[model samples]
Target: MEWHNSLAFAQDQDINDEFAAFREEFLFPQNNGKDVIYLCGNSLGLQPKAVVEEITKQLSSWQQLGVEGWFNGSDPWLQYHRKLAAPIANIVGAKDSEVTVMSSLTVNLHLLLVSFYKPAKKKYKILMEGGAFPSDQYAIESQVRFHGFDPEDAIIEVFPPEGEYTLRTEDIVAAIEANADDLALVLFSGINYYTGQFFDIETITQAAHERGIPAGFDLAHAVGNVNLKLHDWNVDFACWCSYKYMNSGPGGISGIFVHEQHHRDSTLNRFAGWWGYKLNERFKMTQGFVPEAGAEGWQVSTSPILLMASLHASLQLFERAGSVAKLRQKADRLTAYLEYLINGINKDLGTEQYKIITPAQQSARGSQLSIICKSNGKKIFDKLLDQGVIGDWREPDVIRLAPVPLYNTFTDVYHAAEIMKEAASATA
Candidate 1:
């Protein structure tokens, strides 16, 4: 689609957008009493208006029923998490039983590693992307150490060829094959947080399976932002945080997806707790651990009702929006418009003042574009922030801007680009 660098064009596009009304559902941060351009959904999404009502209902339940709230309330606290399975499964493309909301992301990652990262004497190494989120790096390093393997010898990172900003699919597959003999597991992010590059999960999983290695994903940036088919893709396991593109509040519940194939495998180990005990016999106070079938078996503690309430509110909106496919449709166009407008700035200035390091192809990226400022990057970023255009700045020079389909409008992208253009000229 051809993109125009004009405010009227973007406003006209907004007029025709079917999802335009969805933006009203969120409470955007304000600047000078008006909503600021919130392009930072890649970090934390705007709050849903329904979160307050849902949370209040739960608070009232506690007030009226006290301890009895576990069984007596209209929405029983005992089975609160059961309601989340279907909606979350839909978002991540898994069966209802294959998905469950649990602890925070990193915590869940460590728990999942217990089951999936089984290293034999010969096959003892893990392969991953070079610049994975720091939390994942630390988790893998510690897990390797726990197994008596040095991190340097047990962890293999596949990096892009020099002068490149992203990894090619072929390179990733080759790395998996090269380390096939020693690889106990292959783990990767569904999308790189820093570059917004969405990896090809299906191909990567197939490659690992051929090498007799289990493949897992950290979908923190991919679950709600891109199309996923974790079940059909035959991925061994995956986990995601709800706060980013899912519009759940900060530190909201994290979710996990364990393939049905792993559900009945008793050989796997879990750091079991009472919550994962068989649901029907949970109150029996049994002496031994018997996990509930499917992903729910991974739960280690009682549900956090307040956090689940916030997540449920957001999932309802996602359901109303039909599917993640619908969100991606609008997201692609909105993000493209931002890219087009930025390129227009460079053309007008008669120089390549802004270089977009993110993949130009839609299939390889989501809504974010990581731009490298040729000069005065931080000063320009600050100027945009002072003007209330809220995209996030990374260290040194890059600015990560995301056009979230659920809450951001085409006009918001237009205004942000306008402010950015002014910043470019002013700083120059």
Candidate 2:
């Protein structure tokens, strides 16, 4: 496709789009009467159009049936989570039996840690990326403390050598190999939420397993944005929220993946509850706990049907879109276009005014591009926002722009770069 630098090019691209029909699937935010260019799906995806209807259906059941909605409603609140598994499993490269829509991101991390990170006296340390999301940092710190261990001694954080904003793959593998003796777990985000670096999960998992350590992932940033093979990769456990990339709305229900090999391993402990008990025996309220044969075994309580409704609405779109493979094809091209435009800004600055801290290779990142403006970062970011170009700003200066394939257009990226160029010039 020859590049045309105008909205006409965007319109032409939209005209040829197979997923263009999905543009109507979400409600874009309005700024001063027009829709803003929302390049922040890596942070919070736009609301699916069917969410209201899906949520309303659940609301109607609750209004008409009251407590009996648990057993007698349209979608039995008791078994609502069952319907959610298959579609999400496809999106994350998981088997239906290996996936469970569950608690929030950090909460799920703690729950998964309870089961997977049972460190012995000699093997007690947990390895993680140093600049992980704060929520993950807090969760890991608390878990190490709960086990009567000092975080400073037991948590091995791998940092990029002095000046780099991203972690090196070789360094990560080295960290696992070096700690092979004391390592009980290797936990990392599938994608770094800030720097937008997608780790080599298969390589990382293989390295950890070689050291006899269980490997798990907090995929909050990677889940719907990139391809994963949690089951095939043989990752011990993983979890993610549905808000970003999954497009399930703000603070929606999350999901977890437990490798099939661990499904019946009773030695793998979890915080079990009645919902996780065998579906047939659940109403029996038996004294002894008999968990369901797969990922369902990790369930702890009644699911929030309303949240599942929101997620179901979004997952339906994914199924129709023929899964993440087709989605990533578009994402790769769109991100490259955004990158092309951002890289072009260097000449306009008379120097390299912005450095792309995100990985240069398409295979090593998702749709996001983290731009570090050499000077006046916040000023440039605010100016972009003021002009109705909505990209997120991380503190200490980085403007995170994501050209989501689902809703972003080529013109959106092109115009966003134009705004950024102007912002830089204004600062000059």
Candidate 3:
């Protein structure tokens, strides 16, 4: 579809969009007296309107039932996470048995690494993409050190060629092949947080498998934002935080996917707790750890009912809106229109004042466009913020604007772009 840099075109698109009404499900941040243009879902999603009610219901259960709430409530706290398994599995394209809601993202990554990153005398290195999220960097470094290996020697980072912003799939595959002999595990972000480049997970997983290495992914920025087929893609393991595109609120519960192929493997190592014990025998006060059957076997602690309630409310919206497949149809067009408008601004200014480092191809990116501001970048970002356009700015230069399909309108994109354009001049 041809995109026009006009509010009328945007509004018309919104009118035709089947998912437009889904935006009403969220509570937007206000500016002056109206909703601010919220294009920051890539960082923190807008709160779903039903969240408070969902929490209240859980709170009432606690008030009425006390400890009995675990077994006696309308939605039993004992199996609260079960309510989310199928829907979360659908989002990540995994079987219901393969996915589970568990601890925070980094904690899950570490637990997964313990099982998957089995180093040997020869194959003792972990291979990953360079410039990963800081938490990931720290996690990997510390994990290698915990194993009594020097991080610099035990970790291999694949970086883009000089001056390039995003990586090529071929380069990534080649790196895996090149390090095959010494690689213990191959890990990558499904989408790079800084550049928003969606990695070729299937190819990467295939490459690792061919080299006899297990592959994993940090889906912190990919889950719910992009289409995923973790099980079909043969990903050994993956984990993600829900606060971003999943609209599950700040510090929402994170989830994990452990392929069914790994489910019955008894030799795999895990830091176990009582929650992972077989549910039937969990309260038996068993002397040894007999893990539950699927991904739930990885759980290390009791489920947080409040966080699960927030996530439940959001997943219901995701179910009602159909799936990510339906959302992506509009998401692709929404992001495409944003790119068109940003390019039009450059044309009008007669200069490449802002450079989008994200891949131009739709398949290689999600809703995010990481723009490198060429001049007064932070000041320009501040101007947009002051003008009531809410996007996130990374240190140095990049401003990330994500027009989420669930709640963001094309008109919101249009107005935000207009503010960006005005900011370019105002800051200059």
**94-208, model 1: which lDDT tens digit per residue?**
9999999999999999999999999999999999999999999999999999999999999999999999989999999999999999999999999998888999999999999
lDDT of 2 by residue, 251-293 (tens): 9898999999999887987888888899988888779899988
- Sort by lDDT, top down from the best: 1, 3, 2
lDDT of 3 by residue, 1-428 (tens): 87888889989999999997889999988888889999999999999999999999999999999999999979989999999999999999999999999889999999999899899888999999999999999999999989889998999999998999999999989999999999999999999999999999999999999999999999999999999999999899999999999988899999999999999998899999888889988888969899999999999999999999999999999999898988998999989999999999999989998899999999999999999999999999988888899999998899999999999999999998898899898877
Q: Candidate 3: lDDT over CA atoms?
A: 0.93
lDDT, model 1: 0.94
Choose 2 or 3, whichever is better by TM-score. 3
Which wins on lDDT, candidate 1 or candidate 2?
Answer: 1
Could you tell me every candidate's TM-score relative to the true structure?
0.99, 0.97, 0.99
Model 3 clash count equals: 0
TM-score, prediction 2: 0.97
Ordered list by TM-score, greatest first: 3, 1, 2
List all candidate RMSDs to the true structure. Answer: 0.7, 1.4, 0.6
User: How many Å off is the CA of 401 in candidate 1?
Assistant: 0.4
For candidate 2, what is the lDDT?
0.88
